[model samples]
Target: MMVQCVICDILEELDNTAPEAKRLRNRPIHTYMCAACHERVTARTNERIATGKFRFYRSSRRIEGDFYS
Candidate 1:
């Protein structure tokens, strides 16, 4: 399967049988990130974490539950 990196927009070919390729085929909202960009971002994020200033925000499942209740 042919996929493009969401960060760098580089075209890459993936094995059609690979799980990632299947995921992209099945989900339109899921994006593909090339290995290079993935590594770069990981390194940068690690650096920020080491500096003690990185913040990771996650959606609150508790808030959603409360809203439905």
Candidate 2:
């Protein structure tokens, strides 16, 4: 399947049998990213993480209760 990288806007090809290709075919909302862009972002994220400040906060609720029922 032919897909374009949202970051670099480059056109690329993927095997039709690949899971990623299947996902894109099944879900239009899913976007594609080229390997170069993915690697660049990963390196930058690692750099920030190494600086001791980057954090990923999710939606899980904190349990304030200390006693069990």
Candidate 3:
């Protein structure tokens, strides 16, 4: 199956029987990211987290309650 990376727009080929291919075929909302783009994003996110000022604005309500407790 042919899939395009949502981040880099690069085209990649996956085996027809691959689980990822099946997932993309069955679920339209899921997105694909190339390995390089994924790694880059991961590294940048870690950097931000290490800066001690990163905030997760979308944190769960349960976590917010726990924080105030």
Candidate 4:
């Protein structure tokens, strides 16, 4: 299954077995806004990711583009 970002509707697959995945899965279904919207809502999301709240995986395309460009 996928979790859609509250602000942008970008879909991300959920991995329940992985360690990082487990942390997120165990938490409540909290709302996560897109980058821009997150800035307005609060600084929590950015802070969480920075502090290792959850492991993040970017889209393969984005990774490829970043390295190839």
Measured by TM-score, the strongest candidate is: 1
Taken over the whole model, the C-alpha lDDT of each candidate is 0.86, 0.83, 0.86, 0.61
Candidate 4 per-residue lDDT, tens place, 1-69, comes to 356677778877766575645555677565544556667555665466568554446668677457435
Per-residue lDDT tens digits for candidate 2, residues 7-50, read 99999999999999999999999999999999999989879867
Candidate rank order under TM-score: 1, 2, 3, 4
Stronger candidate by lDDT (3 vs 4): 3
- Which predicted model would earn the best lDDT? 3
> What TM-score, to 2 decimals, does candidate 2 have?
0.79
Given candidate 2, what's the lDDT at residue 34? 98
Instruction: Quote model 1's TM-score.
Output: 0.80
Please report how far candidate 3 places residue 36 from its true position, in Å.
0.7
Candidate 3 local distance difference test against the native: 0.86
TM-score against native, each model? 0.80, 0.79, 0.75, 0.32
RMSD of each: 6.8, 7.2, 4.3, 12.5
Candidate 2 has an lDDT of 0.83
